[model samples]
Target: MTENMNDQLDASATFSIELTCPIGLENVLENELHELGLTNTRLGEAQVKLTCDLRGIYLACLWSRVATRVMLPLTHFNMDSADDLYQGVKSIEWSDHLSVHSTIAIDCHGTNKEIRNTQFGALKTKDAIADYFVEKSGQRPNVEKQQPDVRIAVRVKREKVTVSLDLSGDSLHKRGYRQQGGMAPLKENLAAGMLLRAGWSKNSQFSQLVDPMCGSGTFLVEAALISLNIAPGLRRQYWGFKGWKQHDHRLWQQLQDFAKNERVSVDDLTVTFQGTDREQKAIAAARENIKRAGLTGIVEVSLSAFQEHDFSWQGSTPLVIVNPPYGERLGDEMALISLYSQLGYWVTENALGGVCALLTSNDQLARQVPIRPEKHTRILNGGLECRFYLFPVVEGSIKRGDRQQAVMSQGAQMFANRLQKNVKKFKKWLAADKVSCYRVYDADMPEYAVAIDMYDDWAHVQEYQAPKSVDEEKARVRLMEIVTAIPSALNIPETNVVVKHRQRQSGKQQYEKVATSQHEMIVQEHGCDFIVNLKDYLDTGLFLDHRPVRKYIQDNANGVRFLNLFCYTASASVHAGQGGARSTLSVDMSNTYVDWARRNIELNEFSDRDHGVVRADCFEWLRKSTNEFDFIFMDPPTFSNSKKMSNVLDIQRDHVELIDLAMARLSDGGQLVFSNNYRRFVLDSELSERYVVKDITAQTLDPDFQRNNRIHQCWVFQKRG
Candidate 1:
């Protein structure tokens, strides 16, 4: 027989045969094939050209974990049109693959001139096969769309058509373990791919593996199975061999028995797999998936917040994998950034000697994490382009000393360089502007760096860095040195500049410096104290960028009832009340901040019953409040995932609804100032006819924050009566 006929005969009669490997990593797959003793194989793009009989197919399906799908080549032909496709497909010897009564499905994927549409190509191919069987045997197989006995895949690339029998039957990723779905559950195949990319192998020395944001336990289950050397396909009920005419029952049985007998017990291994989530429902889903994977005994699931959970790895370095909620699925970029920042802190502090891989699509938000990822890989998850950032946590005495030295070495120079750059930029910008009273500065340099403004002899500087711990005292001293140097650098008076610090508090004892300042804010603005507390929140009390908004409120607040939702420190309300609003109500949830708002109102001597500060949920208050206002300022938190609140408020998703709600509470021709720091806030077009909205971001932005519009987008919404 010829080479083709002999190969066909070998495939038809033999119980075992070897196959080729996939394209990009043919060498690696070749090594694996050699180890498996399968010598006869070919490699192609995304597919391994392999000649395998039924037994080889069975073994490949059960043992080969890296392959996406295993396909047995049925035929190869060239066709120019649908008619040619039908003629060529009908000529294939279908009897060897499927019987007249058996059901079959055609999955088509193609590129090039002949077969452009995959769906149409699949239909034509199916028609050809069905017509061939009917014309010869007077009977045809039924097409079962969902579960077919035999699945035929047609790939028509570059005018060449190759037909293959899908030996794996179903997608190999469906290892038949997962059942419950949670928020953004990791796909099993993608999870496997990630682990493989992370250099995880059956013999790798991974002591502990964890998925902190595990949704439905995909990674944990896969880790357990891999550690135990369990055949991924053993749990699956059906296989492609059952439908093939040449399937060898005895050989398939032997392969299955071998897989079963060779299965290694992970009990003796030092590896541990665990999953945790903040939601109890997600934890429950994870538990169910673990049990379904027969990994209940091996994998542990817990309902614990990732930021709070203590990761203990028994002195061995651990592998931490996390699929954090991207802002697309989870509302609010700001809240997600804060959460990621906290996650970074937790991982750096606790996972000493561990490695963490974070998957996220938001590059800007990812920068918020303090820990710098040493390696990054691009991957796609559910069509969302994402980057997998790998961070190696340093441990031991050497690591500690290195970290200290690194921080100390960069601390002073970073601050000094940023200060010098900002001073130079500010001077150049101020010289060009006509307004002598205005000031310009770089604020976000060094990420938490602050700069100052000195306009009309009033110095206003916003402190942007938050102190993490007592060790930041060194940074503070360096900041002071920069502050003292700023006057000389900018040719401004030293006595004129004032500083503000911003801090965020989880509770009373859990205070962290969010951002600090050397000389960013003036001691006073228009004779009013502009200094904001920076050591306690994400932002200081005063948003310097919204200076013009405050000015607008101050200019137009006479004889009006003002409502301020999400009134952090009530600076806007103070401006409105001081501008002689007939009545003002500042609504916020934070008692600390509401108290601060009250103090701000008191400072302006507007703290009357008319000028009220209500500490309650803004959504609840908005729904319940009957008081209509002539001027309303609705600037909700850009995004918050607070469990204490009724709903997670996302400005982008809920801006129109918020505007509608504020409009309901607005008097005829009332002015509503809606602001958000979401850099990409796109106003809904539907709101245009009912209200006139103007982009006031340029007008509102303070000179100090001119470099980066971190605080962005303020709009004046006037209801057209």
Candidate 2:
């Protein structure tokens, strides 16, 4: 072409370059480019355009922690149709960048009228490039989608296209130190941007860094690299420039050597990094990543919960950066309120004069931290809109009074006394039966209406919905007192106490999940082990009141084919399996409960072909199955109109048909146990006349349910002799 064009194609010559990052990080990327001595920069949406030489581009790729890709723009043209795109792409001198033998790939973005989809645009661009090479040298390079020799990036906006040569083949987030990350891991570049936003520097006043909820040590590793002046891209093995014709291999090697020499050892660094995570897998992953990053002893990580971890340091104020789990599903956010509150309390009480930066997607959860953020910035992570809050940790700044202890009223004290008395009463029975999961108190006192249940070391408190005659503020205050009294009365930490408002449920609302924390543990009840989650759902997987019913099934389940219909979590089925039932089948409509049942069965070492779980309507399954069961148990919901069901179910109205279906599946001497929580339910007289029906409600009531005798009604049905 021209002499000026030849100079522009040279590796040492200056040209216009663009550095792209996540959308909200434009300003951060600009400042980073300035730090790299490329000052002639203009900011665009998600990109920073600048004029720099090839060495400057290499430096940007090596050191720019926030930028996702470093691109060198070749040309821009207006497009009216697909032919115009083809012509514009073909006009470029392709030989200067790569030869026909090299493999190539195209990544197109921002479709126009001529290109309605990204795939079509990428295909058209590939055709143009292939045609250009074919016409020039009578041969065309092959297309490689995974790892191409040379990668071209094309962006179209408002019928205008910009073609650039991508220098960073993979996204800059792959720092090569992390082999795996925990669920919903933060991107490495985003972590670096967050660190920079929190004002973390090598010579800053902060001498220590702490992350209480550190998942896989992203923030700690990024912060250590930044403090030691280590280049982020040094560990990466591949780049797009390696296949380009004009790539300067000698110059790139020199840059790498310089970066290696410039990095300081962790011993010379002043800041000490510490991290703690509640999950063992997370801690293991973090340790492996830290070892990979060559900071094994320099950065320390431990397996500890957020509420129990110690965040103290011996020197100046520490900067705490936390990227806690923000809950991806609908009900997940409800369980994180206490977690955020604990975080805020720790930062304010323990880290005075320090700074804290928190990242979360839920605004309500963020506001629960009891600290007013000095700055709040909106950012996008993994396509979820999130906010990064920067708080200057100071004393008495938020004015949240006395979070350490709740002022208990006289009513609360009475409730606490009742709780103590109930525990004392159940102490002998619980120990004798080896039952760790049981109801301690069931609203014995009218003024403080709450039911307290203990599962191992944790306490689950559910408040009954107050009447309309009760004042709202008074009810709220009473709830606060109840929550505060529960931990002290039960001798458990406040973090182990889970609180939920109990209300009358209809249809599928009772089965709906209230939280997504999935914090589960194994608890022993009646010599059987079952999984229970106090924080995630309205009811723990194990039904405490059904201890007697499960005991009956376990006592009578020898050598019989057992059937458990409407088995929520299949706890009864587990008991039957342990009772030596020849074969067992558990059926439930909800997929979540079915999966939970599978886990329960597996936990009890009953995951064989004999014990099966089916996710289907119990009514439908009973009608379809031809196999007979010798022992059957059916405990349907009081009322349900689930869309998945063929017909609505009302316990009082449909008990005859349900009982008949279960009886049809029973063998000659098989006995069917029927139960429901409908307090006002009455059995049909005609069915009682047709079959031998006997009320077994008294036998099913355990000591824990004796105080509330009407909690459930039970009956046993069998054929006449």
State the displacement of the C-alpha of residue 587, model 1, in Å, after optimal TM-score superposition.
15
Q: Worst 10-residue stretch by lDDT in candidate 1?
A: 397-406
Runs with alpha carbons beyond 4 Å of true place in candidate 2? 1-12, 309-312, 396-398, 404-541, 544-674, 686-711, 714-721
- Model 2, 1-721: lDDT tens digits are 2111334766458778888888788888898889889899999988899888878888988999999998877778888998878788888888888999999999999988888998998988999999999899899999998779999998989778888888898899899999989876899999998888788865657878899988899999999999889899999998988898877899999999999999887668888999999889999999999999988888899999866776557465789999988855422443455567677887877777888899988886686677778988888998889999988887645646656332345776777788889889988988788887888888788877778788888888787888999997687666655665666688876567787878888767877878777788998865678888887788888778888999999999999999999999999999999899998999999887999899989988986599999999888888898999999998899888888788898989989998998899999988999999899999999988878999999998867789999989999999876
Q: What's the TM for model 1?
A: 0.58
Return the top candidate by lDDT.
2
After superposition on all C-alphas, the RMSD of every candidate to the true structure, in Å, is 14.3, 7.3
